[model samples]
Target: MGLSALFRRKPHERAGFELYGKAVAAARDPWFFGPLGVPDSLDGRFDLVGLHVALLIRRLRKDPDRRGAALAQAVFDAMFADMDINLREMGVSDLSVGKRVRAMWEAFHGRAQAYEAAIEAGDAAALAAALQRNVWRAEGDATPEARLLAGQAMRVAAALAEQPFAALLRGEARFPVPEVPADAA
Candidate 1:
């Protein structure tokens, strides 16, 4: 996909070319399109996050050498700890915020383990196929994480740079996190 397409903002999350009111500070940077995104505005940004997180989770699962693992962990660190603390300034409840963080952590660990296992077994085709399914640039347009996992794999850990206020509360995470991919043992 073209760079413009990859960087295209979600309409529901944006008020025209601008972001969804800048309700979220993290939404303003490239990282928001990172792992799950440092979500600033809660508009379509919420949807972008799930796709990104799922892709990240899948990538981690296939990493036998733990590539980009620390950064993934760090994304959670900021959300569950740092970012969560910061958003408290905005009047969001701690419990609600905590649930969101926990859900994201679950998705990340679950998908990561599954995808990493696939790669370790020399299943490039399977890995690619799995990634293709997660690609946001497809039929309906991509979300934050999907765009991130599209091609390159580095610059991923810091991808989240920070998690938004509601990464796990929507989309794929809302759907039901598979402990392992259906075809896996």
Candidate 2:
């Protein structure tokens, strides 16, 4: 490769990290844990981040431009790196961090596939069921908390669908806020 080519920053790498930051910020929104009833725990937070990342990835993959796909891969890499750092900071032993990260990756992949299929099918019920199984795994039934979270998921998906592919390529995606106000909770 030419020296210039080697030194040039990859657009996908820059956009991917920007988009990933947005996903993390959205996932950390307190409204999800408050009015949305997502459990305010480590597992709950991870699931929420995964949900946002999945939505972004789904959108990126659907773009006709090849760069979108590359950006998606970069974003996925960033997410896992963040997870690994989080595990280490939590005092997880180095010997077991790989196992935990792998398990987390597997869980993320499963959810992404289920969510992407549901969104592609345009089946609200399927999306809700997937959310119930993944996000609400601790809840035995389709409780109100699960329902609220499902609704939020649907809202995020729809908002993503409305975004222009070009805007996404520019790392300008936006998610809609839940209809209910956080203070109302």
Candidate 3:
């Protein structure tokens, strides 16, 4: 590649990382753990981050430009790199980190597929069920929190759908803040 092309690529890569950071920040919002009842634990946080990233990636994949696809891959790479660092900080042994990361990747893909299908079907019940199974891992009937979380996810997906492709390409994506239900207050 020419030097000018290489230089231009760096900005897009940086933008991808910046966008990934936004996803992580949204996932770590205290409302999710408090009113939303998303468990405030490592796994819970990881799942939230994964969900946001998946939604963004899905949107990026729909863009007509090839740059969107490249940025999406960059975001994915950044997410996994952050995961690896997090695992080490959590005291996971280096030897086992790869195995654990692999498992996490599998979980991510599974959740992404399920979420994509549910979102595409435009069925709230299906989305709730998928959220219950993946996010809450609840058995039997869905819990109230699972339903609330499903509502939040649906809102996020809708908000993302409305975002202009130009903004997304510029890494200016934003997810609407989930409103806490009145009953939860």
The number of the candidate with the highest TM-score is 3
CA lDDT scores, all candidates in order: 0.39, 0.82, 0.83
Question: Over the stretch 24-120, how does candidate 3's per-residue lDDT look in tens digits?
Answer: 9888888888877778888888899999999888888777877888878888888898899999998999999999999999999999888888888
TM-score, ranked from best to worst: 3, 2, 1
RMSD of 2: 3.1
RMSD of each: 16.8, 3.1, 2.8
lDDT of 2 by residue, 1-185 (tens): 88899889766776787788888888988878876777889999999999999999988887788877898897898899889999999999999999999999999999999888877887766777788888768535566666666667778888887888777767777987766736445
List the candidate 2 regions with Cα displacement exceeding 4 Å: 1-11, 138-141, 181-185
Off by over 4 Å in 1: 1-79, 86-91, 132-151, 154-185
- Name model 3 segments beyond 4 Å from true: 1-11
lDDT of 2: 0.82
In model 2, pairs of residues that clash are none
Can you give the TM-score per candidate against the true fold? 0.35, 0.85, 0.89
Please provide, for model 1 over 4-57, each residue's C-alpha lDDT reduced to its tens digit, 9 standing for 90 to 100.
998874422222111112112322344434434333454244433433443444
TM-score of 2: 0.85
User: How many steric overlaps does candidate 2 have?
Assistant: 0
Worst 10 residues of 3 by lDDT: 6-15
